[model samples]
Target: MDIEMKKYLTLLLSGMSLIGCASSDDLSLKQNILPLQTEVCCESASHFPWFRLQQNQDLDFELNASSPVNQFDGSKSYFSAFTFAQQSGLVEIRLRSLMLDGEVAIPQVELLDSEFNVVKTIDDAFTVKFSDAFAKNRYELTEKVDTVKTPYMIVYVKTSELGKKVVVPHPAKIRAQESGEPMPIVTDPTYLASNNGHFSLSVETITLSGYNQKSLVEAKPEEVAVVQKPAQPAIQAIPETQSYYHNAIRQAVESNNIDKALSLLDEAKALNIEGAQEVFVRAVNAK
Candidate 1:
């Protein structure tokens, strides 16, 4: 082969090798904690199915979990999450875990100030659960008053077992319950001032595997679109009954007869006409 051809082929092969390695790295697995917006606590393992927080709420303590099956081979890691909003005076928390052995395993919890010094250490029985199974046990830690100026709280756990204590792979997140009842919905500006303050929890989870660059890969085939015949146009038809009801609804809305509009909406919904519910909800919410 010519010298120029040989040099070009060597460069091409090197590029292909790098591309393959990158693709493999992309497919490699990792763990991550999906952060919650508003603060909410995980009431139980059953709640893990679709646990999340609201838009305006925040969390004081949160558990960010990964899929249990995705846990590292021998690394017994702990997740330390923090709250978003600042708080003064006393901050409280309740801890509970799935029983590992015969006795209930008390996970070590520390309340730290802004400088990471241990402000308070808590390991005590504060509440009781009726269930004995790991799934049924409830751990409680309350009345953790700290004098520090930090806005974050850390809850960490590591296994004492020599080997990996293989619990279900999914990481579980929990938060301290709110102290007061939620504020009621207020529609008027004047009435809004009477609404009391509502507190929320903030929890964040970070996955160690997501940081591994070697396992990141980018190997995938680009999509190739194939055009086909367009869909057949259907007849734009309206039944006589529906036409009459639509006209009546339009007239009622124009006349500002809300009851008549609602009654028409109920009839239209029962008929299950296309766009009936959408139009109805729009009318109802408009007022």
Candidate 2:
């Protein structure tokens, strides 16, 4: 080979050798600056965590204590999506929705195109649980492969007691529009103690060494508003008694009117009915 070509080959080999010797610290420095696909976990103090896998990465995300799904890790499940570093390749991602005591049966996934067409859907997945009490857990992860498209992808997950559903849209890139608003970024999850009976959804995220994923703090999932029906009034039963005052109070109790019962008791006491005071006090205490 010519002397010039020989030098070029030598330099190329040396550069590869230097990369092979790069440490974890060196890799962190290059993160976001370059899309290197590895297991990126959420730090303990991370408030909002959601990230997109690079084109070179083969979907390597899982939920655990150290690498929790999100801010509300232990008690709630999490869901989020990130843009693919590239614009034209086909990649797949999995959504794992967790529940406490019992496993959630159907974990539906709807993939929509830019025009909002349902391109793919998953109806159900098997329930999984940990054997040990320390596990005290139940989880439902999508077993099917979700085809993630370029330009963007959408993820839908179910969570909480009634299986509240959420829709997440992940765009291909973070373009700072004139309004300076970024869509589908992390949202602060509600804090609640971990319960074996509550279902939770969460997503993990990380910051590349120099890469800033545009996040809008106010962005939240467009969840369906839940309307809570008012609780039915308790039907208070009257105690069987021969005393007139007691009977009057019982009538009020049966009608589920605390105010009427108290009023009747006061009248009975004013009339100097024997034991009226004691009966009234008892009814009020019972209520």
Clashing pairs in model 2, backbone N/Cα/C closer than 3 A: 49-204, 49-205, 50-205, 76-200, 77-200, 77-201, 77-202, 78-201, 78-202, 79-202
Candidate 1: TM-score? 0.28
How well does each candidate superpose onto the true structure, as a TM-score? 0.28, 0.26
lDDT of 1 by residue, 1-287 (tens): 34653454355445545544553223211111111111222332122111121112323332222111111123332233333123233344334543323223234444555444455545554343433333253344444443223333434332232122223211221111233544444331110110011112223222111122112112111000102221231223235334434544544443344455555556566555466545544433333
Give candidate 2 misplaced runs (Cα > 4 Å).
1-51, 56-81, 100-107, 129-136, 142-152, 157-287
Alpha carbon lDDT at 189, candidate 1: 15
lDDT, model 1, position 200: 22
Q: What is the lDDT of residue 272 in candidate 1?
A: 53
RMSD of each: 27.9, 30.8
Query: Candidate 1, which ten residues in sequence have the lowest lDDT sum?
Result: 189-198
How would you encode candidate 2's per-residue C-alpha lDDT over 1-287 as one tens digit per residue?
24653454355445545566776445423321121121222332122222433444323222211111222212233233333332223433444344322223223444444333546554445354432342333444433232233223333323233233222222211232434666545542221112112223232222222233222222111111112221231233222112434644654443344555555555454444566556545444443
lDDT of each: 0.32, 0.34
